[model samples]
Every structure is written in structure tokens, then in C-alpha cells.
Target: MDKNTIIGILLIGAVIIGFSIYNQPSEEQIKAQQELLAKQEADKKKAVEQQKAAQKKQEEIKKQTLEDTTALFHQALTGSAENIVLKNDKLELTINSKGGTVTKAVIKDYKSLDGAKDVTLFDEKDQSLSFKIDGKEQNINTEELFFSASEKTDSTVTLTATAGAGKTLTMRYLLGKDYMLHFSLQAQGMEGVFSSKTNAVNVEWNERCRQQEKGFTFENRYATLTYKEKDGGTDYLSETSEKIDERISETLDWIAFKNQFFSAMMIAKNDFAPNASLTSIPQQKESGYLKEYKARVETFFDPTGKTPTELEFFFGPNDFRLLQAMEKESKFGKDLKMERLVYLGWPLFRIINRWFTLYVFDWLTNLGLNMGIVLILITLLLKAITYPLVKKSYMSSAKMRVLKPKLDEATKQYDKPEDQMQKQQAMMQMYAQYGVSPLSGCLPMVIQMPIWIAMFNFVPNAIQLRGESFLWIEDLSTYDPIAEWGTNIWMIGDHLSLTCILFCGANLLYSWMTMRQQRDQMVGAQAQQMKMMQWMMFLMPLMFFFIFNDYSAGLNFYYFVSLFFSAAIMWALRKTTNDEKLLKALEARYQENKNNPKKVGGLAARLEAMQKQQQEMQRKREELERKRKGV
Candidate 1:
């Protein structure tokens, strides 16, 4: 039995034993367990309170650390041996010989579109902000900020921010308002420079790529994302950049720039230098986002007699409508369109996912008797639509199976790798005579990848399945629900996911059946191909087990159903095909045609010639070796 099969059996055994124990739980057992827990809690409460008080004191001490950071800023900005704070907001930032440039810069309350209205100090929605020191007061300008609103749109919200000097930077939450929150940063000051840093932002995503790593990198015309957070575990992602966007001018416009998902950066012409590459700058891990960004920007421009260079900022979700209205790379909204499988196989898959989900899903959701079934119906419909392709693949596999014996004989005759070329030439002639194309089966399977990806993305965030339950599963929208175990463990969660287990079993069965059929036909390079496939059979299911563990149970259920259907189809094919008769017929035909004196030889004649050549080569090579050794 395969390792997976053994593991599967063990898992089943464990579940059965656990179930039996759970059902037989006695009142005395429950009472004893409860008493032990109550005593432990009673003994720990006093020490826990004391520890809590100590933690509170430590938190206060940590809060004071922010002021020390603020002091460092003052010392650098003053350009004085002894740093003196002119006022509370003005702090000196030290950048080495180049003068410590802005370490970080961002607008906090202007964090999201909802928070944009609170950014009142800036005028246009895409407004540019820059600060400079003129004697005692800081010279600030929002003209380059480019704050804007639609000609007449009710989704309008008020934006306010502290400006001038000694003003508290504050923004209030706005209710029942719609606005595009836009933010851009100034990090060119750090470019052509090296430092360790981190950047954090609060952003929400409806659907995200699961495989992206924390340090994922993308480079293109507009900007370069040196790295991105793989698992968006934390609220924000930080990146380091070698180049920065040079266009710091104040002309409000949107253009293509490179981003993690799309290609482009949305910005105005006057806010940054022309042709200057835009890049994400990192900050210290311990630094506060809003406070650090402000301090860094202040420090960035301290050199040119405190010349203030304007900066633009955006804060909001990549809603297509909002992105388009903002005119800052509106394509960020393109995400609302299903796009993962746009280029491969058939573009129709993308169109279907984008259109069907938007139009049909919501309407059909009302009739839901467990969204898992709805998902299955959707998959079945898709399969029906693409039935021709899948049928072609099955037929090809059947044809390959019929030709397996002839292919195997060809390999046996040409045992040496160096003789493979001649062996292939002969094998090709046989295939040509039989009118079989070796690639026919693989082509259709390759074509199905895109449709698979489109479905993978579609199922997870499909709101229809959120609270729905299927048989034995409580929630199709989340993972298969199971009560936790008493023994605590880390990383891996306590409850076992039944859907994931079923999904794996189905995958194993499908893989085993497919592999068994291919094993007989494997030859030379194809044998190596079979080995790789076996590895995939083992690895792929385990990969899905971890990945789908947290995904919608409905998605896993869909996969299980698909695999089961495939297994059934394979069984039907095997039962109907007369393999024994087919093999006998092929062998009889080969024997009858072995010495027909045909030109260029057939598969059987080629095998005879190869075997004779193999014997002669072996004899000659052995004789030559003996002579050289003076034997």
C-alpha cells in the first residue's frame, strides 16, 4: 500500500476510536475534569493579576520610547552640535553626510477613502503635500496635493488635515460617504542610499494570491517591488527599492505603473521628478507608521534650507469605480474582474468567471440547498461545456494503452540510451502507420489548466456559500468544522477537516487510476515522465491538504466530486475495453508482418534489427577491451 493510503487508514482508525470514546463520556469523568480545571484557575488568578500589573507598567515604559525617537529627529534637523527643539512639531532628523533624509513619510488619518474626508488640510483628492521650515513656522502647501471630487457625486465626504504650524494632525470618521482614498510616498531621498527599513499600511483584500511570499519581487517600466509579504499575516507589507519615481510635479493624472498584481503606478506629473522610478520604502520594525512617515518626510527635505518637496498619498481599497474616479492608475480596480486565467488555454474561462459570477450566482443563491451542490452544478455545467476536450483526452489515453506492447518491445531492443534516436525513428514510423499522435492525450489535459484556476479563484469568496451547510458539514463557506482536541499543539490547528480528508482521498484514487494506465505505456523518457508524475501524485495532494485546510469547504467538496466522477468514468472505460483481445490482436499482426520484406521496417522488424545490432556491438566492445588489456 502507498504511504498516503497507510496514513489515510491510520487517520480513519484514530477518528473511529476518538468518536467511540467521545460518545461514552461519563458524568463522573466530566465532573473530575471540571474540578481539576477549576482548582488550577483558582491557584493561578493571583499570580496572573500580578503579572498583568507588571505588563501594564512595561507598556507605559514602551510608550515613552516614542518620545526618545522624536528627540533623535530634533538633534539631526537642527544641524547643531547640541540639538534644541524650536517647537513640539519641529524635530531635527539626522541623515549622514548627505544629511539624514526623510526616513519615512505618510498621512495617517488620510489612510482610507473613508478616512480621506477627514484629510481637510489638502484640497484636491490627489493633492501633493510638502513641508519647509521658514524661520519658526513650517511652510506647508496643498496646491500640489491635487485634492478633487466628482463634478456632482453624492458619495462625497469632507477631508481635513492639520497644516501650517503647531497644529494637531487630526481627521474624524465620516459616515454614509463615498470617496477615493489616494496615497503616494516620497522615497527618492533614500534612493542611491542604503539602509534597513520596514513599511506598514492598513489595507483589506477580498481575494489574494495564496502563494505570494513576504519578499515577492516584481520589476517593470513604472516601479520595482523588490519583495512583498508572502502571507499577509500582518496588516501591512514593507518593501525596499533601489530607484524612485522622479516625477514630483503637481499635475493630476493617472498612468500605468508596476504593482504586485497589475502594471502601473497612478500619480500626477508635478508631484515627483519626471522619469523618477517609484518605489516602496521600508521603515524600522518598531516605528509607528503615521509618526515615522511624518518624521522621515520632515527629515528628507531638511537640507535645501528646509525646502519642502510635495508628496501625494492614497488610502483605500482598490474598488474599480473609486480607482477610475481618482484617475490614479484606475486599473487597480481591474482586480474586480476575474483575471487569473486570462492568458492561458481559453479566454472564454475568464469571461465566464467574470460574467457568470456577476450575473448568475447572486440570482441562483436564493434557491440554495447547500452551496456545495450549487458549486457542483456549476462544475458539471462547465464540464458539459468542455466535454469534447475531456473526451478527446480519454480517447487518446485509450489509444496509447492499445499501443503499449509495441512501444515496450521497441524499448527492450534498444536498451542503450545512445541508440534511442534510431529507436525513436522506427517507433515514429509505426505510429504513423497506425495514424496515432503521441501528444493527442496530453494536449487536452494541458488545455484544462486555465479553467481550473478560474474556478479556484471563484469558489472561495463566493458569498453564496458563506453560511450554507452540506451533509455532515456545518459551514460550506469556511473549513470543515470539527470540535477541538484536548491536547494543545502549535502551528497546526486542533480540529481535523473532514472535507480536506475527503478531497485527498478522491485525489489519490484518481491519481492511482490514471498512473496505473500510464505505467504500462511508459518508455525511455516517458518512463522518467511517469516517475515525476508519481512524485506529483504524492506531493500535489499534500499541498492541497495544507492550502485548502483554511479555504471554503465547498471548494474542497467540489474537487472531491470531480475526482469521484473521473474515477467512475475510468472504471467504466476499463470495463468496456477488451484489453486481452486487443493485446492478442496486436501481437498476431506483429508476428505476421515480421518478415514481409517491407521497406524502412515496421515496429516488429525494427525490434529484430536492434536486437542483432545490440549483440554484435557487445561482442566487438568486449573483444576490443580484452585486446587492450593483453588478455
Candidate 2:
């Protein structure tokens, strides 16, 4: 799209967004409103009232079990179960089933997937599991059952544990169940293993039961198969599977399933709550934006016992090609597609990265050149390609700068708020006579935002940058190391990351330079707008500190390099574009147009007319504002 069209669209979008946000209800108010509606419905209908009572009773029972299970899981978080044996593999930490259902699976080895010693994998008190397996041991707790597995197989590993009334719990992984990864969970009375269909996986109880209500509840959000059985009754709850794709299938294995994908560590502290999935897309938090754009998979289990839960997990890359091979979600690979905007210059960037990874990084594997340096090279290349456009923008800004003194005079003359509209129109006429476009300078910068966002997503997730070192930073995939005095301090974490700090400083410097130039050339509300821009720019890096602290150092490195390069380019432009020459040229053009009216005919005159119309609109708006304020 053209610059004018893009800017117009952006302005309209901004207005619509502002109106929407202003009209939207707050969280607490929405909750209260829903509660009131529920109450009103209950008061009107007897059936509604009865349903509410039943729901409340079920909620209380569920809450009690959740709390109890969570507590028990917390106790077992640090300790290992008796019937489980833990073994470490290159890819995964395998928990072998000796003879027990996992009361809790606390995979502590993956605390820091980025390979940090201090970062804890699981919250010791919140994430835990409770379950009974078919095992010889009556009461087994796998305190030391933390393992990793390398191979990708659907081998049936038998698990045995104790249940309520002291019943035997037997569950096994069913091999050749599915092409991707499969878990065939079978209990005493349960028949056949549950498998995912096109949209869902049905968890049926016994042989002949077709009723959905009989110990069954399907959860579209979680993609889980749940079955609840008491002496008198049986119940079931099934959750819809989470997003999955090719990358996930490619990297799918035992280790990552437990570590990165599965929050089994949460089970250590007895936190068995499933990760939020994209069931209600619109109502979902913006935090899930990336998740929806990318790929995710998670699993939850409940083995009926004093503590009934043996959780299995799967987390890894979203490999679209690999997912296409899997039958579960034929759409998994289909949905994990990148947008056109996302692919802007992406092909080039990927090619460059691949070359570096395959050729450069390989040759110099040990002596890691700083990622910061790599970023500088990339910035230099980008700047070279964009130099022509950058120069044009700079020239436009320079022309505007020359006209500023005249604009200031016009502003002062029509200083009254009541005459603001007249003043703005007069200023536009002045610009027309001088041949200047105020917004031309902002077009290039505005167009670069999408590219910036694309890069932001790329560098953080890039496997090439992970574990690679640059200067004092040990891991390019994580925060820079520094001397730590304490732990968990706000912005100043234990040890401040060097790249993030540098990025913030660079941002402040860039903002200061740009603001200084604008302030020198602006007046009235325009000057105030410049000040606001300055404040926003200054606050941006600080705002990102928390969010980006854990991000790949390569991203921070890229920002720092890009800022420095842009500033350098700006400085060069200022030096090359002579103010005197530009003023003389503008004056010469104005004189030529005035003397030879034909020189300003056709399209130029039409543009001048449109500019005049826009200025008139601006004046009218200002007049309305003044009348509303009674100025």
C-alpha cells in the first residue's frame, strides 16, 4: 500500500480501537453482571434453581478434591515415588514404571530450559499430580523419579498404583496407537484406549455406555479425556486438544514432553491446573496471541485414588511438516501458517541465518563471536539497502525544518485558542507557498513497524542464537550475567543483563536526539506532541525490560545495533543535507511557480487544492473545539 493510504488506515484503526476500549466492560464488572443474570434466572425458574444447587454442590466437591490433591502433590514434589526409577537420556528424562502409578511427576532437571542453574523448572508447591497405578506397593511416592528419555516410541510402559477402597490401578502406553505420539490409558472397568478423532478424542467408560452424562464431561479447551467413578455413579470429562503443528511433531519426544511442554513441575507443589488453551478465542487473553500464532500441546491425567493423577506431558517445536504426517489434527499443520506481513524480508533473514548456522557457526563452534557483532553486520546490510529511501525522508525532514521559523511566526500571530483554526489554515497556505509536506518524513518510519515486530518474534525463538555467547554474556538465549547481591528484585533482577541495559540507553539517546530536533522546529500543541513522543520513546525500553529480560540476547543485541545504526544514518543525513542549499532551492522553486503559473498546473495544483481543503477542515475542527470549551 502507499504511505498515505497506510497512514489513513492506521488513523481510522486507532479511532475505532479507542472507542472499543472505552465501551468495553472491566473484568470485575463483567463477572458481577454475569452473577446477577444467573441469580435472576434462578429466581424465575425452579429448574434453574435446582441446576444452580447441583452445580454449587459439584463445585464444592471439585474444589475440595483440587485442594487436597494439590497439597498432597506438593509434598511429593521434591521426593520421588517408590515404584518409579529415573534414568537420564540425551533428549528426555525417562520415568520407568517399576510398579506404581505416579503420585506426582516433578521433572526438576528441566527447571531452566535455557540451561540456567538457578532457574527452577517447577514451582515446588503448585504443580503436582496424585494418582493410583497397578503396582505391588500400597502407598508409593516417587520423590526421586525424575528422568529423561531420548527415543521417540509408543512403547507400553506398565504403571501400577493404589486407589480408594485400596483398588489396583493399571495403565499402559499403547504402542502404534497413533503416528505422532499416543497414550493408551486403561483402568479396571474402562474398555479400549482413547484416541483423538478429527476434532476430539472420546474417553468411554466400560463397553456399552453411549450416554454423554454418565461419568463424562468433554473439555474443548484442554483436549483431555476424563472419567470419574464412585461406587454408585460414574462420571467423565473430556477436553479438546490444544494447538499442534509440524514443528511440534518434529521435536516431539519424551524429554521435551515432560520439560518444556508439560508443566508437571507445577505438580510438585500440588498445582494440577491445566494450562489455558484457545477454546474461546475472542474472550481469551492477549497473552495467548503468540500461542495461537504458533503451536502448543499439553496433557493431564487423573487416576482415582486418595490422590488420583499421573500426568504425562508433550512440549516442543511446532514443525508443520511433521504435524502433517500426524493424523490427530489434520488441520494442525494447516493452521500453523505464516502471514504475508510476517514473511516480509523473512526469506532473506532465514537464508542469512541458515548460512551462518551451517557454515559460519560450524567452522568456529568453540570461539563464539558475540551475537552483538553479528547484529551490527546485519544492521549495516539493512542500512545499505534502505539508504535511498532513508535519504529521501531525511531531505523531506530538512525541508520541513527550514520552513519551521515561518510556521512559528504564523503560530504566534494566531496564538488565541479561538483563532486556532484560522492559524492552522494560514500555516498550511504558508507550507503550500514554500512546497513542503510535513508528513513525508514520518512515512518510512511508520512502514517499518511490521518489520520490527516480525524481527522481535524471530530472534527470541531462533535456535541458532540459543546457547551461543557474545562478549560477557554466557548464553545468547538468556539474560546477561552480572554480580548478584540478592534474588528476584524487580527490574534489577539478581544480575542485570548487559544487552537490555545497553538497549535502554541507546533508546534514550535516540529519543533525546530526535526530540531535540523536533523541539527546535515546533510550536504550540505540535511541540507538546513532540514531548509526548519523547516520553513514550524513553519509557519503551524500560517497559520492555521485564518482558524482554528473559528473551534471547540476540534480540536485544539487534535492537542496540539497529538504534546505533539509525542514529548514525540520521547524523550523516544532517551533515549531507545542507540547510542553506535546501532553503535556496525551495525559494527558487516558489519563485518559478509564481512567475510561470503553468509550472504549478495539473497534478501539482490539484495537490495544492487538496492540501488547502484539509487545512480548512483542520481550522473548522479547531473552531468547534474552542466553542465547546467556551474559550
Candidate 3:
């Protein structure tokens, strides 16, 4: 039994060993495994070598690029910048190659504030323009890099600069016969030079506006920032504010720094980026500068440097007709609506000025009449147009005057406070009987107030009146100084205007004449109050004399002429009106109203309703008093 068991065990063990040997890997398989391990080691070493070589190559490339940039910047900074001059009939521009900026601009047809020299809109010390461009590894400011200038003519110039290898930046300017100048900026082969992170080119423009007019305060009031949005309306900064900082969220068409009579405007062809910003700061009175303006704008710049940007600049006077023609002609390929820069007034007054006053003034100007005479004619036309209202106002006053005697008699019959309501009722009845309304005179004057305010705003801002001479005045736009006190005074300026004096004198005379008529009509405390008010009215003209002493001579003259005309018209009306006849007619009207009370529903019905309301209110008050007194 042991032998058989042992043999079986040995056989099983040999079979198991043979199976294990058969399942074991062959020599070829072992050789293949070793070869694969060797190949993997070799491949890992090759990969490391490749990485090192690539890193070294990249370092070399970066070093070379840094060197090239340094050399280019050195060249740009070392060279002496040149300048090119361009001129036209209206302007002279001096362009510098350093920043490719307009260093100086002279207006040919304008004079300095003192009128002693030709006007310079801006000089090198007053302006700065720069462009910030994103570079591959750094940012570049064009203002610090010198540019090479070529292709200069009487009205055109070109400036160019090399940004990097196969890359260039260029600027061109073309002056026109008028007050406009065309500008263009271009970049070429800048795919590798500029960064791909953004698609905007940042621009900065700074300017300190110079004073070009005789009056600083007057001109400063008109200085402001005006901008037009693309596909939208125009807007402006607050002219009366001290400082302004505006961030535009809409695409912009143009930007302007407008002074009183002149402006410097920049127009973009393709529109500015939506995130542009503008700032304005007014200079102090002692600074001699009109204002300080700063603009930070972004424009589209092709990352691949294929497209160019075009712009236009206007440096000229703020003439209404000229701006209108520019808008009509579409000089910028779109209506710029530049005429809106003129501060005519609000919508209603603006319409009046645009459709009526401006046209009439132009017509008179075309006739070669003096500005003073033109204003006189305008006043006469206005008076003629409003004559009917004036006549009605006078007739109402006359009717009121006719009823004064009867009103006094009625009022004298009631001397107690309890009878005050009854006395007022009687007076109202008398007025109704005479067919007179207290509001009639006041309403006509209220209707004419807009015209007066329009004229007040228009005359001071009229560019046509500037430097115009008439009579003893040399400039109708400024105070016609007849005397100088040699010292500045509050409210009253150092100089006294003859036109202001004449205006105040005429106003006082008008007030006296009107107060005389009112004194004759009023009685008791009313008369006393009116007498005090008449003195106050005289003081009003004196106050006006102080306030308007520094105002425009044309405005003062217009007011004086208007008051003169009013006094004359009022005097003539007083002379023609017959008091006795008016009283008789009022009596007849009273009888007729009594006979047909239902048909007299105009003023009498309103008075009757008012009387009833007063009586009811008095009754309620008396009832409340009785309840409180337990009577």
C-alpha cells in the first residue's frame, strides 16, 4: 500500500512540475521584456534632453527680443525730434514728431483778449496728447517715443515710427481752408508686437484753454464740455459747475471744449469706445487760464494691425449760421448737430430764437444796419406784434380807474372788520358791473414774460454783437463803460455802463408814471401801501443799475428802448381815454347786466359764486365761534 501511494504522489508532483514549467515564460519573452525596459530608459533620457534644449532656445529668443526692444527704444529716445508746419486760411498748425502731436495752433482771423496780438488757441505748454498701446510683454506710450516726419505740404503732414520688427505706427494730418483739420492713425504688421488681451487703444488728451475774449466771467459761463453719442442726441456738462468728471457708457461721435465764442472739437469717424471719460476743471481768476480739460478715450485697434482710424478737428468761432451750415452740409458724413452748442434757451425760447429772433436779426444784419439799430427795429417789431395785448391791458386799467370812485364810496360805508367781507363783495360786484377783471392786465404781462426772458438770454450770448460799435459804445456784447472807479466793488463793477444808467433812468420814469396812475385810483391803506411800493419800485431800478452795470450794453439798450416805448404807449392811452365817457358806459353795462342776469355769466356769475362761498365760510366760522362761546 505504501509503494502505490508513494508512486501516485510522485506522479502527481511530476505532472504539477511539468505544468508549472510549461506555463513559465520563454527565453524570447524574457529577452523582449529586458529590451522593453532598456528602450523605456532611453526614451525617458531623450525626453529630458529635449525639454532642456527647448528651454534654452526659449531663453535665447527672449534675450534677443529684449535686446531688440532696448535698441529700438534707445534709437527712439536719442534722436532729435523735428517739427512740420501746416497752414490754411483760418489756422496754423505746428506738428511735432516727438509725440506726433499738434504743438501749437494759431487762429488767423482772431485776436487776443486785449486785441493787441494774433490769437493762439493753444501752445506747447498748454496741450498734451498721448497713446497707450499694449505690447507683447509691456505697455508702450507713444508720447515718449520719437517719430520720423515726412511728406510735408502746406496743408498736410505725415509722421511715422517703428514699433518693432516689421511693425510701424503712423499719423497724418491735413488742414483745410476752413477751420477743420483731418487726422488719421494707422498701424501695420503689428500682429506679434501688440498684446492679444484687449482690442482697444487708449488715448489721452489734455488742454488748458486760453482766454480769447475781453470779459473773463462772461466767457467762463459758457465754457463747458459737449459730446455727442453715436446714434443718439447731444449732451453737455454743467456750464456753471466748478469741476466735471463724466464717464460715458455709450459710443461717442465727438467731443468738444467750447468757450464763449470759440471751440475746439474732435470728431471721430468710427465712433469711440463706450467706456470713454471726460473731465473739466475751471481755473482760478488769477490763473489767466480759462479752463483745464482732460479726456481719456478708447478707440478700436485691430490686434492684427490692419485697419486705420480717422478723425477730424474743428477750431473756430461759435457762429450760429456757420454751425448750421456745417450740420446741413453733413461735413462729417453725418449731421453733427453742432448748432446745439449755442445756448439759445430752453425748448420754447429756443424755438422762438431759432425761428423768429435769429432770422430777424440776420435779416437786419444783412441790411448792413448797426447792431444798436437792429435791436431797436427788433423791439419795435415785438411791440407792434404785442400791441393788441397792451391795448387790452390799458382798457382794463381804464375801466378799473372809472369804477374807483364808486368803489371808494361803497368801501367807506363799511368801516368795521365784520363788514370786510361785505365790502369785498360789493367791490367785486362793482368790478363785475363794469365788465373788468383784475387778472386782465396781469395775464397779458405774464404772456409777454417769455419774450422778455428770451431777449435777456439772447442778447448777452449773441456772437454777432461782439466787437460791434454803435453810438458811443465800442462793443455791444460787453458793458459800455462811461466811467471807471479804479477799484472793484461788490455787485457794482469798477466801471459804470452808460446803457445801464439810461435803462435805470427810463425804468424809474416808467415806474413813476405807473405809480401816479395807481395813486389816483387807490384809497386809504391801499394808497399808502402803493405809495410805499412805488418807492420800492424806484429802488428796484436802482438795484438793477448795480446788477446790470456789468451786463451787455446791447441788453441794457434793449430794455431801455422797451421801457421808453411802454411809457410812450401808456401816456398816449391815458391822453386818449375819456373818464366821464368810461363811467357812463360802465353804468350802462351795469344796467344791462341787471336786466339779463342769466346772460351775464362771464365775470358776474364767477363773482356771485365767490360771494356765496365767502358768506358760507363766514357763517361756518360764526357758528364755530358761537359753539365755543356757548352763546
| TM-score of predicted structure 2 | 0.51
Model 3 lDDT per residue over 1-631, tens place: 2455569879999999999999998999999999999999999999999999967875565455456755434455436878788997778888888988888888776656667545788889998888777777656677877888888899988888876566678888888777788888888876776666757778888999887666566677778888988888888777666554488899998888888777888887777889788888888755777889988998767767577777788777788888876554334687687877777888888888889999999999999999999999999999899888888877887888777877888789776767777777777777776677755656546756788888887887788888888999888887888888766788875788899999999999988987887777664546766755665678989999887887888999999999899899889999999999988988898898888765565564587578979799989999999999999
How well is each residue in 331-399 modelled by candidate 1, as lDDT tens digits? Answer: 233221112211111356657566664345555565754576677776676667766776666665676
Which has the better lDDT: candidate 1, or candidate 3?
Answer: 3
Best-to-worst order by lDDT is: 3, 2, 1
| lDDT scores in order | 0.43, 0.45, 0.80
Across 1-631, the per-residue lDDT of candidate 2 in tens digits comes to 3465569879999999999999999999999999999987777798767899967874564455446653212222233433332322212223344322222222332334334432222222222222322222222223212222223243445554332332334444322222222233333422112122211111111111111110011111221121111111211122223422222212111111111122211111111222212111111221211111111223333332223232233222222222223323222222212111111135555554444332443344335655656656656766787778777776777877887876787778777767766666666555566666656677657645544565664554443554566677676655664555545576554555678778777877777767776676666767766765675677877887765555556777778788888788888778877799899998997797778765554333455577678777877999999999999
Residue 334 in model 3: lDDT: 75
CA lDDT for candidate 2: 0.45
